[model samples]
Target: MALKLYNTLTRRKEEFRPVNPPQVKFYVCGPTVYDYIHLGNARVFIVFDVIRRYLQHRGYRVMLVQNYTDIDDKMIQRAAEQGFTVPELAERFIDAYEADVRALKVKPADIQPRATGHIPQIIALIGRLVEKRAAYPSGGDVYFDTAGYENYGALSHQKREELLAGARVDPGEKKRNPLDFVLWKQKKPGEPAWDSPWGAGRPGWHIECSAMAMHYLSETIDLHAGGADLIFPHHENEIAQSTAATGSPFARYWLHAGYLNIDDAKMSKSLGNVLTVRELVKEHHPLDLRFLILSAHYRSPLNFNSELVEASRSGRQRLQEMVDNLNRALPGAGAASAAAESRLQAALEQARFRFTEAMDDDFNTAGAVAVLFELGRDCNIYLKEGYPYQRGLLEKAIGFYREANKILDILEMENPGELEHDIREAIARREKARCRKDWTEADRIRDALLARGVILEDTPYGTRWKKKA
Candidate 1:
């Protein structure tokens, strides 16, 4: 069976197929880099990283491109407020964003193109749109002529009437229509300026992505993904700009991660309750966060709180303990039971098939996680009965776990590189401190673990550490 992906444009799970075989082009909207990445942004990054990782695991050479919106209104305004240069402000937050996501185990994309780096591409795209009469320059600002694009509202599935109802502004209020979005903004006084055909100004929010994606991944991408909040105005405008220039489908699949809500209200910077990845990991482990995310479908809203985080930590602890125990039990001393071996083989086949089947169904991480839990249950039973220690059987289980983990982007297998001597020493010191009931030293060691992307968990069995991401 073919892999399935839930496309936001169609609101349905469609069979996934690359435009070109064996090569997948993926573009995801990266951080704006005006501040540290919040947990909401982390959710999007981790979910899409899993998608790209899964594609690669399935034998596709996935060329992933994620863009940094380094020169948006937010960046400009923040730079001015901080009395810093635009590049300086962007550079600071960009590093913070990278460290934040890395701490969450989001693998870096093959290409992370920044909007500032692709100014020429943005200018060229805007120029083509103007030449085609799909965009117009008004009052020194350029906007896409939404009325000219027959499929302007197709991706967002909102009709002209629906858009106008929510727009509040007059349809005739802009360069062309109410739905018309900005492509280039005229520079304001004291703002960072860039030389463009339209004069010294900066790229608009929507144009950065369209330009950067094309610059890095080509005109059309195999998959274009972002948070569900971006479905309208953002991605809708991307389709408008890119397709207006190329006259081709912008992306084969549009994947969107569900939002993260706090106290049942959507988390946003405007809400003033926005929790950065740094903040969340300070209170909870990265893998615990991943476990919490996978507990529900990506298309479903994730309700986050400290209590829920504690629950996630406990759940992940139980699950990882099972994995560790299973690995330990695999290399047994006794001869294997034929029935045990056969049953284990059957269970592996069933779990593996179910895992792939779940991924094949719109990358249903929730379903895949359910299957993993079932595999864990079966392993518990298999453990009770001593097996012949079939190396192949043991490997299949580990491989199955690891492969499924790629789709959800959750599991953190300890890597030697990640576990340097300093980290090991910290862990040892942490264990000793805890045993000595030196609360201050234990907290100090815990902070050190956080620095290394390993979170310390104190269980009945003692201190167990897992990677932050």
Candidate 2:
């Protein structure tokens, strides 16, 4: 079956076809770079990161572009409050965002364009809109004319009339229509400003994405993604500004990850419940958070609570233990058993099929995770009862685990050679106890291993050890 993804633009699952075959141009809206990235931002990055990995696994050369809003109202306010230059503040947070997401195993995008660096592109795009009469300058500020675009609210599925009903021009704003958004804002004292045709002002929040995305990718691209919160004003305005200027589709497929709520409440600063990656990683493993995020469908609301994270921690531990046990069983295993080999191969194929099927259906990460557990169970059963010590069979199981981990990115095992001398000696002592049928000594060694967060399981071939979470 062909790979399919749900496009928020069409509001349905469609077969994924890159504008250029075997090559995908993907864009995701990055953080504003004013402060540390919180859990909500992590979900969008992680989801797209896995999507990019899966696409690559399917043989697509994906060129991913994620842009940072280095200059914005929040950046200006925060920088001033912290007594640092705007550029300095942006640099600090951008570095922190990279480190935090890297801890989550999110690969760096092929192009990470900062809005401030692409001033020429932003100015040129705005100039095109102005020349086309899609935008107008009033008192040194430029604003996109929502009425100029026929399908202004198409991306958000809102009717122009309904949007106009709820829209209100904020104080000190000069726009013909309430739905009109700013393309560029005039300079204010003590704010960062750049020289543009309209005046000395910086690009607005919406225009920065259009400029950077179009510059790195193209006027028309394959996929554009971000958190669901961006759908309305941020992404909606992007569609208007970009498509109006280019006279082409801004993005063919639009993907948005769901919100990350804290204890069933919206994560907010006033609530004192906003959790950042820097804070969470100190206590919980980053993979645990990744597992928890994947536990729900990408488009579904995920509740962040201590209990759920604990569950993810335990689940990841179980997967790790299974991998360790299967690896340990490889040492003393005999030559291939055709029957066992056949069974393992069939199980691996089935798991792989299910995983692909899940991922194909709109990148169903939760369903993909279920396939991992199923593969783990198959390996465990084979190691316990279906084993005549088939080395090939164990290897196949290990290979499956490794391949799945490419997308899941949850299993990280310490090298057995890196195990301390004392731990290796303990493993050997346990083996000797079992050889002598000394049940008391064997149990004592097992308890000692448990104290070190290690678990030992007896298989048909031998006893294997794994570290607990």
Candidate 3:
């Protein structure tokens, strides 16, 4: 089946056809670079990472661009509170963001432009908007003329009255329409200033993305993605100014990941429930967090808690254990009967089909992951049957896992030597206890291993250990 993704712009699932086939221009809104990235932010990044990976896997050459907002109001305020220059603060947090996402195994974007680095592009875009009469200057600030853009609320799908109900002019502002948003902010005392036609000031929040995306990619890109929270004024403003300036669609397809809640409640500063990716990695494996995020549909709200994370960790370990068992059994196995090999091959083929079907339907990672577990279960049954394992069949099973891992990126095993040694020692002790008829000792060892996320299954071949999922 061809790939289909839910486009927020059209409010429906549409078959993905880039403006140029086999060359996708994907853009995702990156962090503000003022503070450590939290789990909510991590969800957006990981979701897009998987999308990019899947696109590549499907034979699309994707040039992904994710920008850094290095000079926003939040960055300026945070730099002052932390006693650092704005650039210093941006550098610090940008490094932190990269480190955190790398730990989660998210691939880096093809181009990561910073707002401060693209000042010329931003100024030139604003100049084009001014020339087109899409924006106007007031009190040394440049604000987009929402009235000039007839389809102001097209992206957000809100009526003008609905947008106007919530819009308001801030104190000391000179916008003709409350719905109009700033393109450039005039210089404030002691703040970072850049030379632009609209006096000496910095780019506003929305314009930075429009300028950077168009400069790096094109005026009309394939996909634009961010969290669902950005569907409002941020993305809405981006659509208006970008289309008005270029006289073309900003992005053909829009994707938004759902909100990530903390224990069934929204994460907020007043609640103090925000969890940073850096801190969570110290407590749990980074892959576990990535797995948890993908366990639910990308557009479905996912709840993060200790229970869910532990479950995800166990699930990830279970998949890894299947691969490890295949490795261990492959080295010491004879050829299997033709019937056995045929059965396993059929199962593998079915799994491949199902996985592709799921992923093609709007990148349904949850369904795709279910296919992995189902395949793992089939492999476990085949191993337990004690048939002479064929080298080709075992290798094929491992190959399927490797193919899935390329897109999911959740099956990486760390320190396999050390872990294997420990499991071997524990199993040996249990075998000795069983031989001596020390049932209590054997049971205790079994329970202890189970507690440590290992499961022992006594087969006719011998006592075998797999991870507890």
lDDT of 2 by residue, 1-469 (tens): 8999998888998999999979899999999999999999999999999999999988999999999899988999999999999999999999999999999999999999899999989999999999999999988889999998999888899999999889876887788888898889999998889998898999989998898888888889999999998999899999999999999999999999999999999999999999999999999999999999988999999999889999898888888877877776677788886565356678899988999899888888899889989888878777677655688888777887788789878887443434678987998898998999999999999998899888787855556666565
**Which is the leading candidate under lDDT?**
3
What do the candidate models score in CA lDDT, each in turn? Answer: 0.81, 0.89, 0.91
Q: Candidate 1, TM-score vs. the true structure?
A: 0.85
When 1 and 2 are scored with lDDT, the better candidate is 2
Model 3 misplaced regions, further than 4 Å: 335-342, 413-415, 418-458, 463-469
Candidate 3 C-alpha lDDT tens digits along 1-469? 7899999999999999999989999999999999999999999999999999999999999999999999989999999999999999999999999999999999999999999999999999999999999999999999999998999899889988899998875887789899999999999999999998879999999999999899989999999999999999899999999999999999999999999999999999999999999899999999899999998999999999999999998888888887888877877777655665466688899999999999999999999999999989989888877467787788888888888889999986332443568777989999999999999999999999899998788877788776554
For candidate 1, lDDT tens digit of each residue in 407-456?
Answer: 66566543323367888788888888778899999898798779868877
> What lDDT is obtained when candidate 2 is compared to the true structure?
0.89
lDDT of 2 at 49: 95
Candidate 1: stretches off by over 4 Å: 168-174, 269-271, 330-340, 387-392, 415-469
Candidate 1: lDDT of 331?
A: 51
